[model samples]
Target: MRVALLTEGGYPYLTGEARLWCDRLVRGLEQHEFDVYALSRSERQEARGRVGLPPNVTGVRTAPLWTTDDRTLHGAGPRGGRGRGARRRFLACLAELAEVVCRGTGPGPDSSDPDDMADRFRNALHGLAELARAEGGLVGALRSEAAVRTLERACRAPGAPAAVRAARVPDLLAAAGLMERALRPLSLDWYGDGALGSADLCHATAGGPAALPGLLAQHFAGVPLLVTEYGVRLRAHYLAAGEAGLGAPARALLASFHGRLAAEVYREAALITPGNTHVRRWQERCGAERAKLRTVHPGMAADRFAEIGERGYDGRADASGTLLWVGRVEPAKDLVSLLHAFAEVRAAEPGARLRIVGTAAEGREAEEYLTRCRALAARLFPGPDPADGAHDDGAVSFEEIGGPGVPDLADAYAAGAVVVLSSVVEGFPISLVEAMFCGRATVSTDVGAVVEVIGGTGLVVPPRDPGALAEACVALLRDPARRERLGAAARARALELFTVEQNVAAFRGIYLEIVSHCPVRRDALDEAGEPVPFAHPAEAHVPGRWAASASTAEAAATPSWAGRETDGRDRLKGAAV
Candidate 1:
């Protein structure tokens, strides 16, 4: 079966967190053909370009979200991008969208009810979508003065929130621009009978525009959508509101817009797969139905860590007990609390050492934070010593083991007797997983999915508490047998749940299940290039049907091939019980 894998700011983009996972998923499932739909967030990311894709990946289509000049679609005489009727429709859609956003999304007639708000959002969204398809584009209209005026009226509308009322002209312009950028997908030529619409299933690797194409594919072609979210895109949008320096009004409206969009996506999707329970919980809280949610852990290759794990522990967790902390150096890593905890660890066990080994993340602030961490480390465990080792020269050694001297993630994990994750904010705790793969016992703060990931395989401490963190470290440090046992268990758990093989197997099953229930959308073509949609055997064309032993209720929930080939016989025959 053909899968349209969708992504935004990631996947194929060389420097994204989700890129590696997407590559693994696509490569692992070589039996299925994939067409990638990617949205780049910056020129730098676009310049970095895509990594090599598998042979099964038939094509890659990309669009920029960085900058869009309105003039490109403007300056058309009387009959330009849209005619008068289409222009009116675009304006009406924009007005309704701005209104729905300002009123907020939730339960009461007050517009806070997500269900009610979702209806309004969907209606407005489809209205704009229809205009884009019919008029050729909405870029010019979306950035026009007409769109700005519609937003102003919405902000001034009778029931508008105080924040909306407080929006000045500058704020209106900012919000309008933000909305236009967010909705740019409506004008893209990626939709229709030939593009995303032809795919058997649209699989979005992330949310937002990554899933937006899937949403459109379902809307336009009746194709089933399987949206896989490693991170909750809506929450990221909310956090990004602050990072982008958007005003309160703009941020609130944008948040509501994303919330309504996510609800509609969850409502329409055939299934929603989250990489972890932490991501799952966020989807659940965002109006995703419990019936539709599935947890699929992101896959990681375990072979690289195999060598270190094979010779792990050595029956002694007591070689001065080096405490290792690894991850991008940022304020959120809570390196401050980690330094304090290490001080306490030093007080208890004088010979105990802490080695912080990782580079700072991108940004001048991360650099500043690293400087502060170094100063704190110097004051806490002062002076460089000759006996520290070839790679080290201080009580608290800050080394870039990512270099040629001590390369490989396994080496970093093996350097420590106890792996420590001190992040105050985290997602999936990749470092903790890496440590597990290296067969090292861990002590991670209670943040993100650390507690869930540990699963009794490691000690957990509350975040931002040096005292609690210190105690956990000391307890594990003083006990070698418990540490070794936890290390072994952690490695076993990682291999079982998070390995490339297990992740591939889970998704392979999910892909088969989704395809089995839904009929393929690709139309069979004759020599004249005439459309012979569904001319292929209903069961034979159905991907994974050959080995699909069981079926889903979702299969029979809707007519498998509506508006096209399925008569009653075909529908019932395609249904697998």
Candidate 2:
């Protein structure tokens, strides 16, 4: 099978989210051919450069979603008087989009109404895609005064929210700039049959900008789209919107646009695989069809920690009363609560030690948080214990990870009897998973997918509550047998669900299954000009050569739930937003 793997801000880059996993996936699935389409997040990420490509990956194409590329983005405006018609169409689509974004509607992706909010959204979006494809691009038009004016008109239209109506010139500029960036995929040249459409399957590593090409491919060539989101993009956008820079109206509009876009993608996708149920619920709330949803855990290589995991068993090898917390030092990790919890643990068992092993995050927020945590730790556990006559192993020690002292990740996990996670905000807990992979019992905060990942293998406490967290830690520390059992179970669970072998096998089956199910719309020919049997889109349900009335033409191209059940087409008409 030929898969077009789409990624945003990661993959192919030597360092970024899912970089190694993507390489692993491509290498593991050697039977398939892969063409990577990556969207870079920053100049620094680009500077880090691409990773060594594996043999299975045939080609790579990338575009800058962060900084605008000079040569293409700043080209001359549309030639031969194409401007007036384009502007008029753009305004009409913008009006409908603004109406939907300003005043939300529908029950998400499961809605059965024919002319629902999604259809309106799809029509407007594809109109813009068509405009971009027809002209050289929409780069100039998207940033034009006309676009701004159109947005202004939509904001001030009747029934629009007061927040959107209050948009000033600065707010209008901000909204326009954001829209131009969000709609950048429409201006791209990858919509044709030769690019994304050529693939047997369109596999998006994430949602939002990364899935945009897949949407275009499905629209143009009736290809199936598979979207896998480890981290929810809508949540990221919601969190980012609160951070500042943009005006209130712009933020509101951007959030609405992203929310609606997510809904549209969910509605059109053949399958939606979330890394955990936490993300799955988010997708469900955002309107993803229940049937289309699947849960695929993030794949990890267990071999790195295999030896330590196997050796640290029976509560006999290198057992200590020490508790270890390992991960990047971020506010989300909630180290302050952990420090307070450690204080409680010390009150119960005076000999107990807590070692915070991690580096501070990159930026002032993390630096300040780390500083506060160190001060709190000092206040909680005053000085080195008098029992330690020679090597001063303090009650509470904060040491940066990845140095000569710790040496490696396994060393950090192996240093303590119990691994701790105190995060208030988390996706899949990589540190907790790593701890489990090291065959260590864990105490983690009940946040994000921590509970789902733990699967009764670790003790979980409500986040930000020191009493409960401390109690859980103390309970596990006293019971060595319980800890050993949990540790063994955790290691077994990690091997079963999170390993690379299982991930590759699951996807390999899915690829073959989808290929088997989808109907072949086009036939391929051999070198002798004879029609090849079972050439592409697999063997079952091939479409016959038939003419369709303009009204019902798109019924043939509608995407099904995991390509399993039939769903009617979302015919694209009206102006492009």
Candidate 3:
């Protein structure tokens, strides 16, 4: 089958969150041809270029949300006026969105309001669809100062909250910029004839703006949409908005837009695959049907770790078994609490040492947290070789992966007897999985997806509780036989469910199941001169047909529809019109 894989700031990008997993999926599912529609987040990310593309990838089209294109609308005057038909559709969508936003602003009834919200959502979506069809794109209209003025008026009008009424002109401009970016998907021209419409399925790599194009694909092309989210985009939006100093009213308005978009995506999607149960709950809360939801864990390669766990169990550290914590060194990891817990572990077992490995990936948050941890370590383990009899210098060692100090990550896991995760917040806990794969016993704090993923193989502790974390670590440290047993069990579990092989197999089956359940339909003629169905990727390339043209051009051209082409093949290429 031909699949349109939609993504935002990920996949093809050389540096972006979730890029590797997406690349793996496309490469693993080579049975199906893929067309990647990507939205890049930054100029730096676009400049860095893409990861290697596999043979299965027939096309790759990208647009930049970081910087708007210089294209301007021809019909609109300097003051930005539109024709009667354009005005009617624009107001309809805007008004419907406004009503939905108002209803969800903590005032509307819960029982009946969601249905009302759904109606409003469909109206807004259809209205935008019509506008896109009529105007060729919504870019200029959405980016207009007049659109921002309309939003500002609606936000500050009668029944507006005191918070919204207080919004300044600068705040409105910022909100307008955000909306324009959010609506970028509407301007993409990937929803026609031989583009997404030619695909057997539309698979979205993530939600939010990434999935918007998939939604359009389903809308305009009659293609089925499959949405897979490892880290729920709606949750990330809420978290980002909270941290970015967005005013309450602006946040409320923007959140409503995302909420409506998610609801629409969920409603239209044939299936929703969330990486963990934590994300599943978020999808459920956002109006996804239970029948369509599936939980698929992100697969990691575990062979290297499995071999170490099976053969190197006896080679672990002997004295005061060191506790190893590996991940980005950020405040969220709660290394301060890990330090305090190590202090307690020292009182009971004087030979204990704590080794922290992994560099911070983000801003100063990681470096600042590492600095504080070092200072705390100095106070706890005072002298050189703090484990010596001179004074209890709580032995705390810090190292970075790929650095001259620590060349290999696998070595870091093998250096210690117990793997510790003191994070107060976690998603999948890759470190714990790595420990399991390495055949090392683990003691991880109970946080997002920890208990679910560990499944009794590792000792779980309450997050933010130093006593509990210490107790769990001490128990694992004291009993070598039990640690060996748990480590072996954890290794088995990781190999079984968390391997890339398992992940690929699960998605391969899911693709077949979804396509089989809801077969693709297209209005076309067959050999008998009767109306026939279009089913497979090969079937789309029959001679004397448009699909045949696509196949021939695909072979003769640059092997992708990523750039501008004036040939007949360009007629079906996916791009912003």
Which one is best on lDDT?
A: 2
lDDT of 3 at 529: 79
Q: Between the candidate structures 1 and 3, which one is better when assessed by lDDT?
A: 1
Q: For residues 1-577, what per-residue lDDT tens digits would candidate 1 score against the true structure?
A: 7788888888777977588888988999999898887777887887886798889988887776666643432221112344666565667677778888888732233536656667667767777665566555565677778888898898888867786787777777877777766776776767655567778789888777677778766766667789888776788888888888878877777777777678788888889999889989888887789999999888888899998787888633358588988888888899999999989999998888887778635788898888898787777876774123333545687666566525765776776899999998888888888889888999989988888788999999899999999999999999988988999999999988888888889989988777667654455777999977656445545455433321243233222111111121110100010
All candidates' TM-scores? 0.88, 0.88, 0.85
What lDDT tens digits, residue by residue, belong to model 2 across residues 1-577? Answer: 7899988889989767878778888999998999898877777898988888988888887777665444634442343367676556656666666666665522233233534767777777776666566655565676777777778887888766777788899988877777677677776666555567678889998888889888877776667789989898889887886775787888887887898899888988888889999999999988898998989898998998998888865343335688888888988899889988988998998878887778646779888887788777767766763222211367777666665547687877877888999999999888888888999999998999999999989999999999999999999888888888999999999988998898888788877766666655456777899998756543445443322221243443332211211122122111111
Worst 10 residues of 2 by lDDT: 568-577
Candidate 2 positional error at 391, Å: 9.5
Please give the CA lDDT of all the candidate structures. 0.75, 0.76, 0.74
* True-structure RMSD, every candidate: 7.1, 6.2, 7.5
Residue 321 error, candidate 2, Å = 1.4
Off by over 4 Å in 1: 70-81, 105-114, 315-317, 385-391, 520-522, 525-577
